[model samples]
Target: MRNRAPRSRPLRAVFAALTLVAGTMFGLAVSAPAHALGNGLALTPQMGWNDWNAFGCNVSEALVKQTADIIVSSGMKDAGYQYVNIDDCWMTGSRDGGGNLVPDPAKFPDGISGTAAYVHGKGLKLGIYESAGTATCAGYPGSLNHEQADANSFAAWGVDYLKYDNCNNQGISAQTRYTAMRNALANTGRPIVYSLCNWGQESVWTWGAGVGNSWRTTGDISANYTSMLSIFHSNVSLAQYAGPGGWNDPDMLEVGNGMSFTEDRSELSLWAEMAAPLISGTDLRSATPATLSLYTNKDVVAVDQDSLGKQGTEIASAGGADVLAKPLANGDVAVVLFNENASAQTISTTASAIGISSASSYTLNNLWSHVLTSTTGTISASVPGHGSVMYRVSHGSGSSTGTTHPLIGASSNRCLDVSNGSTTPGTQLEIWDCNGGSNQAYTLTAAGELRTLNGTLCLDANGQGTTAGTKVITWNCNGQSNQKWNVNPDGSISGAQSGLCLDVTGGNVPAGNVNGTLIELWGCNGGANQQWRLG
Candidate 1:
């Protein structure tokens, strides 16, 4: 859930002392480089089973044990699925006398430690959830100010992964609250993979790598094509922010949650293509053969677990047809042709467009059909609606052409301007009448920066700000994260530093189309103000 108003909690004397010591010891402004936490966890997107989508608050010790047993027996363990996570409501509504979370006796008779041991015995890790607020989404006692005590409790319980959620956060900056937990987890001397669940607000991806192993890039996903497609579009653009030890999570896999079989396959394919964490949110004990097959497809799972850790790029997207290509470690590329229409559509792209070099011929290995075919250069497929076709291409060749184009706002139909056509650094960006001037022509480079002014000035976030409404300016090309941009498939461009959209200021208003509307970074709301097209 997104940030909500936190409930008032009466501070106990003992908990106060503990909080004071924690704040003094681990609170001296925790910061890290733009890389991951560097604890050597989550080198690739995490593969696991989480219980929120299928079971909700109905989790119990028996259910968790049975799921772990089934994962091993059903070949999922061999296919790379590991963690078995318990979601919210695992604890009682209140804390104990020591200000520690207490597992519900009815649900976890042997406590969380017992469950963790049982899962560990099966050669799998255990995960648990907690909110960063005074109360969880289900109204259970949360870790808000008690982050230290809670971290200790989880470590003592042998927990291997932590899913920290956003609920009743009291409007605190996500950076401050999440950083506290990251510090607390480090203090415990245990290796716990932290997963940030802030629903993508505050551009978490901009700094999530320095804090946690994975961060959600959108709102929760439902089991339908529309929700999946929307989340996919939101996440597919943030590829530059994802790599080893950190990822852009698009929420869990809703494979068996009532979507059609084709839609389920597409969800898995797109998630794999995006290098997203593959946490199955379904009841494994009752999963059908097809659902299990979708979860345990070694070929598709290999694409997700590829060592290159490069998130797929959108080669071409038009109408309801989309093409995505992810480069693998072995000089091979994984390609997907997806159709989002109501019927069937043919999608096509060349090997060169996907960053492959020319060769005598290209070998295409169909991931789903397990069939082999040869292509001289073009990769095309007639895909069913709500379905996808994925392939592993080997020994292919292609080249990319660089082009500069004008970025037009979807709402105002104006050009992105450099504010008086200044060449100086820190000249704030704006929207003006589209005259096709050099100021409006920006070239998106393979390194992910948007360069203009004859490739001298790159689009940058002023002061390296990671919050919404930050000034968007032009700076000298420096190859920094603040200057990187992701041109998304939904006609929106987002900053690699902030993960926020390049929005026309006040563009949601009636007078937003004036000749000189300033542009800034803001939360992506799917509004016309945040949408842009390049041509």
Candidate 2:
């Protein structure tokens, strides 16, 4: 998420300093809270329904009531699904005489208070939306200048949750915008769960816990598995930021929203594996029983809601198949073996791979099957193509398991050469001095696109250029063969653009002089000159 544009004037010197001190004090208080709302505000991987995906900007009080009814009638509420959140566009064009926010009279004739009353009567918590910026993402009036008024209004309306977004005000720093809302909520004395929606801008994970109950760490999630996986994997490194009173939200769940379920289990398993907020974006009123079953799986929910509050990380992958390993509070490890390939593929992992080795014995509880099996020191299973097998591995002796970084090649010595650094999308590709900057950080998206850390496009040769010295530059992503670059275990990147590896042009040796050196496609010769590490 980008930062909003600054609209308000700067604060006075003393007021600014006091505000900073207040913020620090607030951070300390929240971090060391004696109690969080009720036993901590962290959602064991928040499982609820959000209206954004299905309803978009057309949310209404009747719609929320209807959704709440469906949630209870469909048995999802009984399955530990609690929140019925209204995403965006729930506000009217104007505020009331008392300076309180009013719901859209046409869509929410009973107003927000009535809507909240109805939702509360249904035995469900109510959540609403606002923008930290001047305008909401959906163009509705935001709470940018009306933080206290809106917060008080929400408290009066019995709101239990608030999804505050960062939309139009692009000039304000995320900390300032988030802090304003936090202060407003605190002053209101309402126990509203504050959700900071900054799209991961400005290192939100670094400070989100001090400001909000949950924070979005990625862009909006699509219904497809690839999109969902991309968002989930993007935040793997920030997992440690999540704890008892805060969570890293990877957007909402897309199950049953007309996406393929061939490996829907893999998606759900990965979400649970990451301990991500699991706000369902599907229509509960018309969802299939199978979908409901997926949502109501208690075993998976247990993994997500683990009291330890530890998020999972990727263990390994082959081709498109990958494994994610998460450590539970109970000294058990949750492993999700996923095959994201279009065709069937076998995936297997031993307990040793996830840093678990014992006296030749272990117990595996398959979360989907809700069954248990005893296996030797090595635990291996055949994961179907586009599917996954989620297991909770417990030690036979009930001893605590040690955790190593689960990702393969995570701690490897590799350098990513960003020869031409620019904020622009497409620039000439070249080898440069490695300084471990944002320009050097590359992310292999779940959609198979090699993107810069700031979400810029990574380009390939317009045509297959197998010959050496093929120039590379950024281009709009079309998922072409040339656009894909595979990072091998040895720190060499092979470009799909020409089926050739990225080579340091002419073996440039100097540090800063390598900045403008051209990048070329060459045959893999296993030369140290050609190997580039992703530092």
TM-score of each: 0.69, 0.66
Q: What lDDT would each prediction earn against the true structure?
A: 0.84, 0.69
lDDT of 1: 0.84
Candidate with top TM-score is 1
Clashes of 2: 16
Assess the local accuracy of residue 360 in candidate 1 as a C-alpha lDDT between 0 and 100: 79
Write the residue-wise lDDT of candidate 1 on 385-435 in tens digits.
Answer: 777889889984322114677877756667899987899999999988889
TM-score, candidate number 2: 0.66
Q: C-alpha displacement of 241 in model 2, angstroms?
A: 1.3
For residues 153-234, could you state the per-residue lDDT of candidate 2 as single tens digits? 8898899888888788757788898889888888887788888887766667768777888788776778777787677656
Q: Which ten residues in a row have the lowest lDDT in candidate 1?
A: 5-14
Runs off by more than 4 Å, candidate 2: 1-39, 397-535
Model 1 Cα shift for residue 355 (angstroms): 0.4
